[model samples]
Target: MSTKRYCYSCDLKNDSKLIAEYKAYHAAGNAWPEITKSIKDAGIVDMQIYLTGNRMFMIMEVDETFDPVKKAELDAINPKVQEWENLMWNYQQELPWAKDGEKWIPLEKVFQL
Candidate 1:
C-alpha cells in the first residue's frame, strides 16, 4: 500500500547531558513498546527521528486511513503515551519561532522528486 509522508522538526534543550540521555532512551531496545504500538495503531506505517546538535527531524509514513488530529486525540487519552510525551518534554524545547504549546513544527515541502 502506498503511504503518506509527513515531516516535522523540533529543538532539544541545549544541555549536553540531557541530550545524551534522550538519545540513549531512543536507542535499540530502549524505546517504550507502548509508545511504538500506539503509533502503529494510529495508522503510522513507519516513523524515524534524526538529531543533529540540538535539532530534531522526524519523518512519518502513514496509511490512507491516518488522521493526525484523531491520532493526537487518541494519544491524549492513553496513559502510556502521555507519560512518554511528558518525559520527552523534559529534554525538548520549543523552536524559537514556535507559538505556544507547539513542539514539532511541520516542514513545508519546497521540492519533491
Candidate 2:
C-alpha cells in the first residue's frame, strides 16, 4: 500500500502570548486525544506540524483512500472534532492569499531532487 503526503500552511495570530499558548497546547503530553484520534480515523497515516514564529507548516501522510472532502464532512458532524477545531481557531488565521473560509492552504511543489 502506498501513502500520499501533502503539505499545507497557515498563519497564527502574531501575538507572542497567543503563540506561546498554542505551542504549550501542542507540547509533549499536552495534545488532545480526541483530536488525534479523529485525525487517524480520517485515514491519515501520520501528521506533523511545525511552527516558526507565527507560521505553521503541516505535513500529512495519508492512506491511499484518504479523501479530504469526506473527512471534512465527517468532522463537521462530529461535535468533539468541531469543538477541537473551534478551540484551535483561537490561535490560527488564514494565509494572506487564502479565500475567506480557507485554512491550511495547500502548498505548491516547486522543487524536488
Candidate 3:
C-alpha cells in the first residue's frame, strides 16, 4: 500500500541539558502508551524524529485516512495528548517562521531524486 510522507521541523530550547532530557523522553519505551495510541488513531502509520543540536526533524508516513486538521481536533480533546504537549513545551521553542503556538512547522520539499 502506498503511504503519504510528510516532514516537519521544530527546535528545542538551545540548551544542552534540556536537549538531553528531551531526547531521553522520546527514547524507546519512554513515551506514554496513550500518546502512541492517539498517534496511531490519527492514521499515522509511522513516525520518526531526528535531532541535531537543538533542531528536530520529523518524518511521518500516514495512510489515506490521515487529515492534519482532524488530528489537531482529536488532540485538542485528549487530555493525555494535551498533557504531553504541555510538558514538551518546556523544552521546545517555536520556529521563527511558525505561527504563534505552533510547534512543528511543515517543511516544503524542494528537491527529490
Q: Number of the top candidate by lDDT?
A: 3
Give lDDT: candidate 1, residue 108: 93
| TM-score of each prediction | 0.96, 0.95, 0.98
Q: Runs in model 2 with CA error above 4 Å?
A: none
lDDT of 1: 0.95
Q: Summarize candidate 1's per-residue lDDT along 3-113 as a digit string, tens digits.
A: 999999999999999999999999987999998888889899989999999999999999988999999899899999999999999999999999998999999999979
Residues 5-111 of candidate 3 have per-residue lDDT tens digits of 99999999999999999999999999999999999999999999999989999999999999999999999999999999999999999999888999999999999
- What overall lDDT goes with each candidate model? 0.95, 0.92, 0.96
Per-residue accuracy of model 2 over 19-56 as CA lDDT, tens digit each? 99999988886888988888898889998899998999
Ranking by lDDT: 3, 1, 2
Best by TM-score: 3
Clashes of each: 0, 0, 0
Answer with 1 or 2, whichever has the higher TM-score: 1
